[model samples]
Target: MDNITNEEKQQSIEAFQSVIRKSENALASMKSGSAQSRLLEKRLKAARIGEGLLAARWEGKELDVSHDELVEAKQVLEGLLLMLPGFLEKTKPGSGQRTYIERRIKAFQMAVSYLNE
Candidate 1:
């Protein structure tokens, strides 16, 4: 894994914080056990994972997965990226849910990039 500058790490942490807050607010309004709620929960989990990964990388302890595992993860995230637009379309424009989806897309893209590197 490439070493990230401190400036980049700080910016990423801040971005993750914003995404987490939005996701939490959106999830609070969603009915528990519903499909939408479940999906948002997954996205929230991803965001937390991404944040932890960033921190680990910054500490010079990047993930020790095999190259094959990284490639597989990147492929999975790519597939999700292709499907997210349909999910985004189901939400109202300018709504908190839509914003959360957008943030999720961004988080997934960031993960893909990290895996690619």
Candidate 2:
């Protein structure tokens, strides 16, 4: 994503919007206290952050994220980092899923570092 062209970033922003809408719809259908709803909420938040990141990039500027939002994103991503290793271990070595998980881990680490800064 760091190397994506402007056109690609625009597409990513659109994709993130779609995810946010769908996640919102799904969240509406779930029980308020259900684990699924909680997970969906997190997904929605992540999509929003991703979209904002892309939008800022498109505008040729740094993201103007709020302190609280950055903290929330960092917490969510750190939680995901804790869980991803289990899934990564289950995938076969050299598999596409494995590679994807690896990349995702790296991306999350980078995001956490950026947020910290």
lDDT of 1 by residue, 1-117 (tens): 256566656666666777678899999999999999987786676666666566666676866556665565566557778998999999999998787677667656767777666
Q: What's the distance in Å from true for residue 113, model 1?
A: 3.8
Question: What's each prediction's TM-score?
Answer: 0.57, 0.64
Residue-wise C-alpha lDDT for candidate 2, range 1-117, written one tens digit per residue: 466566554545555566678889999899998989988898679767866765665577787778788788778877877998999989999998786677666556555655666
Stretches off by above 4 angstroms in model 1 are 1-3, 61-110
Candidate 1: TM-score? 0.57
Q: How high is the CA lDDT of each candidate model?
A: 0.71, 0.71
TM-score of 2: 0.64
Question: In lDDT terms, how accurate is model 1?
Answer: 0.71
